[model samples]
Target: MVKEIERAGLPVVHICTVVPISLTVGANRIVPAIAIPYPLGNPELPREEEKALRRRLVEKALRALETPVDGQHVFED
Candidate 1:
């Protein structure tokens, strides 16, 4: 789906726990999730802490969209 969207000329970021899979699928903009069970949130953390983590993940995704790249790229903290 990310590939199809990018093929349409719109930038896309793939947020997933598996970075290798996203790269193999040809996602140019990639953001790593905390884990598979809780992709955006960590249940072990407090509510506020989980929210902060989610925010960081989204911010990275937005940053990935603005970056220019020739192939797959993964955004890091």
Candidate 2:
């Protein structure tokens, strides 16, 4: 639905582990997620570390949303 949202003149940032799929779906702004099962957090990590990771991911996503893109763009660390 990223394309659909953009079609309506709204920007969307797709956060997913699969970058290719996000591109195929026509997501203009993409953020690489940590993992498939835990896209936003790592349960194997300590609570604080996981939180920090999640925060950074979210910040990147927000940055992606704010940035302008002519086509599919993947925001990577």
Candidate 3:
């Protein structure tokens, strides 16, 4: 999926909890998520805070798209 898109010349950033899996699968742009169940939002967080966290993660993904890399790169919050 992600690799196929990148192979076609489109940039792809994968947001996933398992960094090792993403790296092993050859994901060029990676963003570490909170967890597998709720990668974007944490139920424990206040609603507004969760929203902010999601936004920050998205911003990191966008930044990852603009970054050039020779291999897998993980962007952390």
Number of backbone-clashing residue pairs for each candidate, in the order shown: 0, 0, 0
Report the error of model 3 at residue 72, Å.
Answer: 1.1
For model 3, residues 1-77, the per-residue Cα lDDT tens digits are 88999999999999999989999888999999988999999999999999999999999999999899888889875
The alpha-carbon lDDT assigned to residue 3 of candidate 2 equals 92
Model 1: pairs clashing at backbone N, Cα or C within 3 Å:
none
State the lDDT of candidate 1 residue by residue for 1-77, as single tens digits: 88999999998989999999999988988999989999999999999999999999999899888889888788888
**What would the per-residue lDDT of candidate 2 be over residues 30-57, giving only the tens digit for each residue?**
9999899999999999999999999999
Runs with alpha carbons beyond 4 Å of true place in candidate 2 = none
Rank order (by TM-score, best first): 2, 1, 3
Model 3: CA > 4 A from native: none
In Å, residue 20's CA in model 3 sits off its true spot by 0.6
> In candidate 2, which residue pairs get closer than 3 Å at backbone N, Cα or C atoms, i.e. clash?
none
Q: Residue 65 of model 2: what lDDT?
A: 88
How far off is residue 54 in model 1, in Å?
A: 0.4
